[model samples]
Target: MSSSTQVSGTGVVAPPDSTGISIIVVGGGFGGLSCAIECKRKGHSVVVLERVPGLHIQGDVISFGPNAGRIIQRWGLHDKIWELCRHVDKLVLHNYLGEIVREQPLPLPLWGAWGYDGHRAEMHQVIYEYAVSLGIDVRFGYTVQEYYEDDAGSKAGVRVEAKGEVVSMEADLVVAADGVKSKARKYILGYDDKPRSSGYAVYRAWFNGQEQGVDTDPLTDYLTKGEDAFFGWIGRDVHFLASSAKGGKEISWVITRKNDFEVTDNWSFPGKMEDVLAVVDGWEPRCAATLAKAPSCIDWKLIIHDPLPTWISKSARVVLIGDAAHPFLPTSMQGGSQAIEDGVVLAVALQLAGKDNLPLAVQAWEKIRYLRVRESQLIGEDVRNRWHRCQPGDRGPMLDVPRPEWLFAFDAEVNAYEVFESVARDIRENGYNRPVLPPELAP
Candidate 1:
């Protein structure tokens, strides 16, 4: 196949490119898929390995701010994705007492970013299928047990199960988009830093509103009665969020509160409705009325790791992207968006650096991303802390989520093309620069 050829009948119109590097991407989620797609679109040969047996659309609401929306638009998946999204019209904030705090209109123009927020599985499938359509090689049920690279050998690879036996697959570069509990950390960091609690947990649930009786119940029908609705109620130390999507066909809800569950190696466990009711007891009556209909929820404990020293390994042939490299607090809703950004920027980096400068491309990509990701991660912590300490006067400005242009308005693909040269040159002369943390974050 020609480097610039578009897969027939798909109308993918992958942007023209000539990088021609063979890349192996680990994980098939948003980050991994984005990496594979962007790389292929840029004319790189890419393979994606996912441990899961098959594609599963099983997660609730996921958002893609305009920064990432721009990337999706380039891929020709925007309109298709919007069709499957909830199309939230506004965000209505409420106090625990049921009094309205603020009802803000949706899609704030942070520079023409029509951020899509909808079922996680739905958004993921749009990207996943698009990658497959482009003739990219994506293998599922192929669990990667280890990642390895040889700068001296000029290659990187992952060992995975194939035909009932482990096989070694090699490429010019290997990407670990593996999740938060990534084993790749040991290889990249030399030591795995354990994840500590962020002192919070969320009970998440999603179900058919009609089936769950929420759409018909007099106390809760308002949630599903009209256009996609998003509601949030913040209390002393807890916050409850609920929404109607799929045009009232589905209902989703979550409650983030102080974590009372004992910390353990595993941070996710089953949630009890009684516990949910207990925590949300004083919230608006409709809040409990809606929650009582939930079949069940997952108690997910938010965990954090110290700022990583590097996302690239010594070989520079292997690197970590997405959750594996920098897991975000839920408050930083950009976790998924930034992961997609990493994929886009990485492809641009490799393309511009060319095949011979793999080391510089890999390391410099990390330097280019570190500070932006760190600052975005900090937003979550700042917002969560303020929400926890919610005060009488804080309901207006403090509760409103900031949608800044510097963050939401970014176009990773174009930015990479513009800045890669300067950033890469800086790395060559001075070395890959890592930012120093604020005194409060520094240990």
Candidate 2:
């Protein structure tokens, strides 16, 4: 079949006769940019709209497990990521007293072995640059306010508020890659259920690796000092995670707590070095001393959303992806990775559908993506809650509930499709069914 074909009755313009689909991805973060690039690779036109001025969404450090690392490698971003990422070689869990509690070596044998590295900024830059190089029309500072759809509920477009004007643009498909607190999601939800704040606050900071000198023997004793691994000092209600980043040029510090104050989901706020210091004042001298030299900090509040009824909206000609679809806590570190996976699968599904059925392809997309993404969000929250319980003397005996292998072992491109196909088959079998879990489960 050619890339695109006009139906006998409908007049909607499709992808090029030689291309499979045309898509607009809202949000230029890792996931959005990746989807745009993958779609272009599959012979489709893509446009990325971002509210931020630049692609750099600031954060201290992020880890990509072996599964996610593979996608990063496949995207031709391995080299660039490695240049900026600190290769953590172990997984060290510690008690609030700065004592090593558990240690596991990083399983991957090669640095970029399976296509994973750990730099937030580096990964963002690579995806952003690659998307542009591939001809994705990334329009920055474009705030997408709403989505509008045709009467058929098959075609859709996004309404944007940019530069003192409202602009609406149409597309064969509309992807809401917007972050949590997404405006597009409201249209997809068709109801009002806002994201809830978890009352958790985190202070993030970065320091020069050489100046901080965190590799000293005493620090390594309890810190789980290695490549790719991180050390955490877990307390009753607060904890700190310290990891290496920027290829060892910098050390990333994070302090999280269930503070009573309502925290906003802002990641760029200037963190007070002294405020963070107050938390660990009595910790081991070595850990305290090292953190004292921290150069800068960023503040972020933890926000969470309940599981949505479904991420696809027939009336809005829009669907949610990435955080816009399912926002997870930072503890899972799978947020960015999952979005990257979504991009890849979205591109593949669109290509396979043939442009004659663009709307059908998007429906297939929601069927393929919703469950896996939903499961991921739940898993992240579970981990955060469990890890949050490991502070001080409250450290429970080795957790009886083992980690879900499916969560980390997942290969989005390979495994996510299986889930998607099932949903599509069910949809076909059930006749355009929309999932309705009990009211208690609806977001």
Q: Tens-digit lDDT track for model 1 on 320-390?
A: 99999988877777889999999988987887788899889987788788888888888778778777788
lDDT of 2 by residue, 175-244 (tens): 8888777888778777866767777878877666666555554653233234334566666667677776
What lDDT score belongs to each candidate, Candidate 1 first?
0.82, 0.67
Candidate number with greatest lDDT: 1
Q: In model 1, which runs have C-alpha deviations exceeding 4 angstroms?
A: 1-17, 108-110, 151-153, 260-263, 433-435, 438-443
Q: Tell me, by TM-score, which candidate is best.
A: 1
Instruction: Provide the lowest-lDDT 10-residue window in model 1.
Output: 7-16
What TM-score fits each model? 0.94, 0.83
Question: TM-score of the candidate numbered 2?
Answer: 0.83
Candidate 1 has a TM-score of 0.94
